[model samples]
Target: MEIGFEELPVMNLAFVIDKSGSMNAADKMGWVKDAFGIFIDRVRDIDFVSLVVFDSSAR
Candidate 1:
């Protein structure tokens, strides 16, 4: 059995991203951004998302 998008339920997603100075190392920040972009692409239109970025702080 398989479930299609029409049968899927709404979702709520919360992402806590790390933006410390080290994140810039090895292009980690860029990689995370690209990965998150793909993740966002997979979200349903009715879903909700909250992104919190932190680096020795929360904003």
Candidate 2:
């Protein structure tokens, strides 16, 4: 089935990622950044995305 913007409801998405100690391990952070880049390339024009990364002691 074909879907159009006018026929669909608007959406808001929030991605909350943990940037704690573990995420800073070897290449793990890099991988996450790379994957996010790919995701942006694929969906940049299709939808709005908000990235929210948090650490153990901070927002």
Candidate 3:
């Protein structure tokens, strides 16, 4: 199933994450990435999404 982004209204999204070494444990990063991927899939192309991943600092 797919939602057409062209007809969707414009919106803003923000995704914050931790990229520290501890996040690499127990497949945490994998799970987070997977979840984010699925979530981003739901966003429309006309919308804006921001991904902010930080470990020791915000980049």
How well does each candidate superpose onto the true structure, as a TM-score? 0.88, 0.65, 0.78
Task: Count backbone clashes in candidate 1.
Answer: 0
Between candidates 1 and 3, the TM-score winner: 1
Writing each residue's lDDT as its tens digit, candidate 1 over 17-48 gives 99999998899999999999999988888999
RMSD of each: 1.1, 3.3, 4.1
Candidate 2: 10-residue stretch with minimal lDDT: 4-13
**Per-candidate local distance difference test:** 0.93, 0.74, 0.88
Structure candidate 3, residue pairs in collision? none
Question: Model 1: C-alpha RMSD to truth?
Answer: 1.1
Name the candidate that leads on TM-score: 1
Candidate 1 lDDT score relative to the true structure = 0.93
User: On residues 27-59, what C-alpha lDDT tens digit does candidate 3 reach at each position?
Assistant: 999999899989988877678999898999998
Please state the error at residue 33 of candidate 3 in Å.
0.8
**Candidate 3 residue runs with Cα over 4 Å from true position:** 1-9
Which residues of candidate 2, in runs, are more than 4 Å off?
1-11, 44-46
Candidate 1's TM-score reads 0.88
